[model samples]
Target: MDRSPLWDTFKALPDTFLAYIYAEKTRLAMAEESRHVVNENQQIVAGFHHGYEASDDQYHPGTFQPFMMKGYWIPCSEGKLFQLRQGHCSITRTVEGQDQILYLVHPKSATLFAPLISKYQHTQVDVPALALSSFRTLLIALPAGGTTEFAMVKVSLNEEIGGVRRLLYQKECAASVANSSVLKNKQTEKFTCLEENLSFVPDAHLIDPKEEAVQLSGAGMIHRPVPELFTTQGHYIIPLYALFGINNWPLLNALIEQSQTTPTQFITGALLRPIAEEMVDHIYRQRFYLEFHGQNVLLKLTMDHNDLPAIDFIYRDMGGVNCRLGDVQLHQLPEHLRGHAQYWEPNFIPDAAVIMEGIAKKVLFNLTKVFFKSEPTTRDPEFCCWRAKMTVYGYQENWTLPGADGRTDNHRTRHTPKTFYRYGYFEKIFARELLEVMTRHGIFLNIKRSCPDYDYSFFMDKIGNIDSCNTPCVEFEWFSELVKMTLPHYFQHQDAYSRRKNISVVRP
Candidate 1:
């Protein structure tokens, strides 16, 4: 129980942070008054007490152990001299004391902590020191209290991704439906990755020293406008992976859990933006660099998307058995030197790391207002970072195709597609299996008996009397029955595909 949460950080503030005045000292004093010191075995270490719910009839039905944050202790004051061996100020408060800490952390200042909270909730991992430091400017504000000397740190709400980012800024778009369409005026845009000094390093040679080697990183990115609106009368809309629903990706889910910088956790661009990212050089696992534009500075980070969340990836990069040339990521093979061992890593899933090439699509989504704690990486299992639980979905996209108007070079337009995008699954392999299971489940029997001579529509009249004087088919029950009967078999084939499959809900 004393273990720190994954993604939680107890780091010393950076030099730049000590000079930044992010909070008012007055507010800090108000927060400290809420604190109380209780005795634990004749010693004083801060703590909190609360009535936890446990029974179904009691409006609550769960057990809870109040978490204690891992905060650094500075005995030499001046906020310097971060003595690690000194002490840790935890959330271990008495009933009289709420989340008050060694010093008062502003309530609104809580925005800086959204990302750290989201990360811990999802994977139970404490973030690295650097991650938490990025948002330290918004952490607790020290108070020179009057009669009592107490530290009141912010009480993290343990909200989903939204709560994490809200600690840093104003309203977050992802957490609230009202803020969802905030960027209606901003149109999406696209940017391409400058060509890296691409050299087809021989299978037996590593990347040699070249001037361009400095530019070539472990990751790359391509940016483009968000996907054109799926709806009409469209305004600039934000895209979010969470909106992807059951048909989403493990990578997207992971991003929602990691990022605290922006409101992207749920706010996907109305259109898509293809972004290229670079990886850390020479790490066995893939690492990437993301550029975060802040008020005073711009920063780059080398990280693993699997380790951090909110990674912007192109869906087109993912290739399956049915992927097309235009629908894949275009990642040049790294200089493997020998046996191309790097290709065998997990980043090569869904075929290969093929970034999209030629007439491609791009989109954008953001998770606004998340503040993740980036602690130092350690082998300790309690605070070690990990990716979110992964799940793959395959479903046939039922959409219309755009007409060939050579002047208009866009697949996603205001008009509906006249046809569907045919890719990502093999009908021949699984369709037959579904047909057999469906037959065994007594589907064709009803069809055969109802319209043995003609198609099934004719028997609709026989199955039930149309309540209206001029209607053609049977009752709604007929439709529901058909759905319940065939859907199981249809999904069976669908579940087999890690990418895409059409449920045979099609009635001829």
Candidate 2:
């Protein structure tokens, strides 16, 4: 018998290389098992079959009910494939005990998504290829490099969605990513740049031949699998969101503290400062906006001696990105980004002030506040607090004031007095306790305390000076009141609300 090509290659290589090939073969076998189509009618892929429970008794109250629905497994540039839903609803049945519940997907959502997916499949939308209708089925390409474990693990996570809670969690996260994208900074490449976040949608044409409306299955709908499984260089790196969310706080903290120095050093020295500086400079100097809220950010913790957390700062959705294209040097930007600017609708150009406000809202309020407030106990509350505090203050000193006067960059357009009047409230109380907390932490032992001298009154005056004819006093009051509700108090209110809701019976 003739020797196989793989065998011939193996024989020509060193003996050590055979072990790698053997491992590759093993991985391919597992992937083949996973991508196998279990139910031809439903297009149910295999491997996930192990997680399926035949009886409702086996499911957690929090798990989405298990049922087979029409879906597709779209392949990434890396050999991995993610299952996406077709014809609107991924889950097609009502819950067993709940008669009021009809379906997981709304009719309106499916109606809107169907045409979008079809258009992507047939036409070039300048969007990610996942929008295409033709990308279907978990096709396992043999001998593909890298461990299939992450892809399989993702599949398992999808499989374990057996309760309503799981469904809701997925829905909420997806919605958040979608909504946050609209708030991203749209500034051109002269001063700011961002990663485009994209989500998976089922090509109904490929997955649903009958073109029937997707019904809610007690078995939940499959969502687009995040392609973050593979890095830009094609390496696999797990995101910190998974560890933090999966109740692996210990692992996260341990990784943070693994170095000889404190968690603050690891965060500040290795990860935080560089990114913070870049963001602040761009926002303040160029008036380019961003929404780097934690969910959109991914952190990769190394188990090696280096103790590095490789931060993949991804801004996936483009809808919220606000920027002044006229101020940007478009030629300096890469090709795809150039396409983004060229393809953008002409009317969507936001005012310079609006982009600055977006930075304060998304980056400062949403990212910094939420992180420090929610996970205060994750590391030493002191460390998280300082890091968060410093981040806010650094932005103000380095970017905010400088950008107001065009001091950050000579080429950048400075914020006009009118623009300052609109956005001054943000500068006034940004990270309200940051300076006070820094003093207490002794982080300012050598540095002079300048918070007292900072002109809070000027910003306050700007706020009051706004003409009430166009900008209502009520609107300014609402903004002030909203900012006053700091993250800690906001979360406290949420906890109280949740406690009240969770109390099934109360005695009078």
**Best prediction by TM-score:** 2
lDDT of 1 at 43: 41
| True-vs-predicted CA distance for residue 256, candidate 1, Å | 35
lDDT of 1 by residue, 1-508 (tens): 1244411221233323222211111011100111113243434232111112212221110111122233321111211111112222331222333221122122222233333233233323221211111122223212223321122121222122312321211111111111111112112223111111111101101112231331132111111111222112212111222222222233333443454323221222211212211111101011111111111111111135444422232121100111111111212212221112122234322211121110011111011101111212332222122100000111111111224222211122121121211111111112223334335555455445444552434333533322211221122223223333333333333344314333344433
Number of clashes in every candidate structure?
115, 30
lDDT of 2 by residue, 338-425 (tens): 4344232242223323433433433333222223323445555554554444444432322223333322211112222222122222
Cα distance off (Å), candidate 2, residue 110: 4.9
Candidate 1 error regions (>4 Å): 1-278, 282-508
Provide the lDDT at 88 for model 2: 23
